[model samples]
Target: MSHRPIALEPAAVDVEVRGGIRPADVRHAKETVAALTRLAHEPVLRATVKLVASPHPGERRTAQAVLDVRGRLIHAQATAESTRKAVHLLNDRLRARLLKTTRDWENLRGRELRDGEPGRRHPAPPEEPLPHRPRREDPVIVRRKTYALERAIPDEAVFDMEQSDYDFHLFTEAATGQDSVVYRAGPRSRGDGYRLAQLDPRPGLLGPVRAALTVSPVPAPVLTEQEAVERLEFTGRPFVFYADAATGRGCVLYHRYDGHYGLITPTPA
Candidate 1:
C-alpha cells in the first residue's frame, strides 16, 4: 500500500543541544528529528528535540523529543553512549509511539485499519535505566518546579501522562474543579493499571471516564512540605502527592534520578 508522505515545515521543528555538543552533531540531531517528524500521518504542529550530555560513563548522551501533533502532545526519550546513537534510538522510540497512538485513535473511532496497514501496532521500546547515583547520607531537595496545574478530565490527564512517560500526573479535574492526580495503579498486566485520587472528593461528582480507573475513597492528605517530606521518607514510595496545607494546592515530592529529591508545586492560577 502506498501512502502520501507528510512534509513538516522546517520552522516548526526546534532542536537544542546542550552540554558542549559540537555544531556538526547538533545539525545531525536536528536533521534526524526533522526526518522523523515528516513521517507523521497527522499535521505536526510543532516538534522539539533536546540532547544533553551525561556526566556518567554508562550513558554518555541523552536525547528527548516532544511533538505537538494536531494539538495532542507526544514525548519520547532515549540514551546511548554516543550522540548519534542516542538520536537514532530516540527516533525508533518516537516512531513506535506514533504508530501506536494512530492505531489507538483509529480503533477508538471505530475505523480500524486492515492488519497490514500503515498504522499497524508497534510495541514501544524498553526505557533505559537511570544512571547510577552515588549513595548519599541525606538527600535534600535539589530541584523545584512550580507551574499552574493543567485543568483536564481524567482521560485527558491519563493521556498526557502516558504520552509524557510519567508515572503520575497532577491536574485540576475539569468536571468537579478539584485538584486531582491519576497514576499507574500497577504493572501493565494488571487491569488498566490506572488510579485516581481527588481532593475532598464528593459523591456522584465524577462523570464517565474512558479509562478504567480505581478512585480512592479517602480524600488526598493535606500536609505541609516538611510533613510531606517526612511521609515520603517513611513510606519509601517513589513519590508522594498531597494537598499543601498552606496554599491548598496539589504538590508532588518525588525521588530524582540523582538520588536527590525534587518537588513540583502548583502556582496560583
Candidate 2:
C-alpha cells in the first residue's frame, strides 16, 4: 500500500515565525526541513514530510518550530534578538527529531531476528548506544547478484510477498508489459489490514541499472469496507504496517517494529 505523491495538508507540522524573525529566517527553516527530507530517504529508512510556515503571533522576540507525526507533536521555542539565531536553534531541534526518527527506523530494519524455529522470529535487544559521530563515507563493500523476475497474477504477487522475509519482491505484471514491483504492508491485527503496492522503475535513475524507490508508502486516513478490510489482515509478533496506493505512483506501508512504525515509499532522486 503506497500513497502517490500528493499535496498533503501536513497536518502534522506547524511553524510560527516571531516578530524578530525575518522572511529570510523562515526561508532557512524551510530549507532545513527540505534537506532533512532528502537525507532521511536512504534505502534503509523513509518518511513523509509536510512543512507549514505561518506568522508568529505576539512577542516577535520568539520563534517556534513544531513537528508532528502520527498525531504527536514536538515543539521547540527560542527567544533571540534576531530571528536568524532563533531559527538556527529551531532548525537544530527539527534535525534532532529527524535524527531520532532515523535511528529508530534503523533499529527496526536492523532487527536481529533469531530463528528459534522454522519460521518463528525472536527480536534481539538493540545495540549499546553509539557516541555522537559525524556521517562520512567509509567505502562500503558492494555485493551483487542477479535474478530473473517471472510474470505473476496479482494474487500470485500476494503469495510471493507473504512468503518472503524481505520487504519487497520484484515481478512482472501479467496484464502490463512492464517490469513491476510488489511490496508488503501490515502488522495490523484486528481491523487493520495489509496492502500490496505496485511500481514500475523502467524510468529509473540509470538505464541498465535502475533501483525502485526503496521505501514503503504512508497511508492517508480513509474509510475501509468491511469485506475489503477483512482481506487486508496480517498476524505478526509486533509490527505496524499501514500502507496506501496513490492514484498512480506506488504504495507505502507502515512498518511494525516491537512498537513503532513509519512511512515508506519510492521518491524521485
Candidate 3:
C-alpha cells in the first residue's frame, strides 16, 4: 500500500531575541538559520532561533536553534561573549549537524541495498561539554522531566541522541525489552566513544548492534532518588544511571550546565 506524503509547514522561521540584542544581530541570526534550513534533505517543518544575553558574569551571550526537518529534530547551541560571535558559532555547529544527518540517511539507504536489512547510521562526532558557571555549593534538582521512554535499538537510539544534540539517551531496548541508556563514553574510553547500560543485562540476549557498543558488565545499581544524587556527587560523572529502588525502573540524575541537577524518569508503559 502506498502512503500519503507528509505536508510541509510554512517556510517562516521563528526568531526570539532577549535582553537588549541589537536589531542587526537579530536579523543575522534569522538569515543564518534560514540558510541552514535550505541545506536540509527533508522538509523544514518548523524552525526556531533563540538568542539570550545574560547580565550575570560568566553567563555569556547564547544562541540556540531547533529545526524540525520533517519528523526529525535537529538542535544546536553556542555561547560567546558577543552576540555576533555566538550566532556565527551556532551556524557552524548547526551546519555540521545538518550535514551529518544527511550523510546518515544516505549511508542507511546504501547499507539496506547491500545487506538487505536495516542499516545503522554513523555515530555522532564527540560533543564538547557546555560552558557553565562554577558549581553551586548546594545544587538542587531544578528540572524534573518524566516521560514515556522511546523503545529503540541501540543504533537507532544513538542516531536520535545525536540528532537532538544530547550527550545521552534513555530508552527501552527493543531486543531484550529492558530499560537502557546509550551515552558518549568520553575520549578516555576504549571503543568508539559509545557505551550502553541496561537495568538487568543478559550476556547473549541482545541482538546484533551495528554501532560499536560497550555493554556495561555490571547491572544498573538499585538506589533511591536521594541515593542517586549522592552517587552523582561522589562519582563526579556527567550523569548517573541507576535502577530506581521504588519503581525498579532506570533513571538518570545528571548535572546541568547551570550548576543544578536534572532528573529523568521513565513513565510507566
lDDT values of the candidates? 0.74, 0.36, 0.77
Candidate 1 vs candidate 2: the TM-score winner is 1
lDDT winner: 3
Candidate 1, position 115, lDDT: 47
* Model 3 weakest lDDT span, ten residues long: 109-118
**Per-candidate RMSD, Å:** 5.1, 18.8, 4.7
| lDDT, candidate 2, 1-269, per-residue tens | 64232221323223453224455655665665445443342321222322222233332243445443333333444434455655565555555544545444334323332334211222212211111111223312122223455666444543344333234455555665333555434331221223433343223321221111132243322222221122222332121222223323222222221112322333321
Candidate 1 per-residue C-alpha lDDT over 126-154 given as tens digits, one digit per residue, 9 for 90 to 100: 55543424345787888899888888877
Candidate 3 clash figure, as a count: 0
lDDT of 3 by residue, 131-235 (tens): 543468898898899999998878788767766667799999988988999997764223455799999986488877666678998999999999998999888
Cα-based lDDT at residue 7, candidate 1 = 51
lDDT of 1: 0.74
Candidate 1 global Cα RMSD? 5.1
Which residue runs does candidate 3 get wrong by more than 4 Å?
Answer: 1-12, 15-25, 52-56, 59-62, 79-82, 103-127, 188-192
- Positional deviation of 73 in candidate 3, in angstroms? 1.1
TM-score of each: 0.71, 0.26, 0.78
Clash pairs detected, candidate 3: none
Q: Model 2 Cα displacement at 156 (Å)?
A: 42
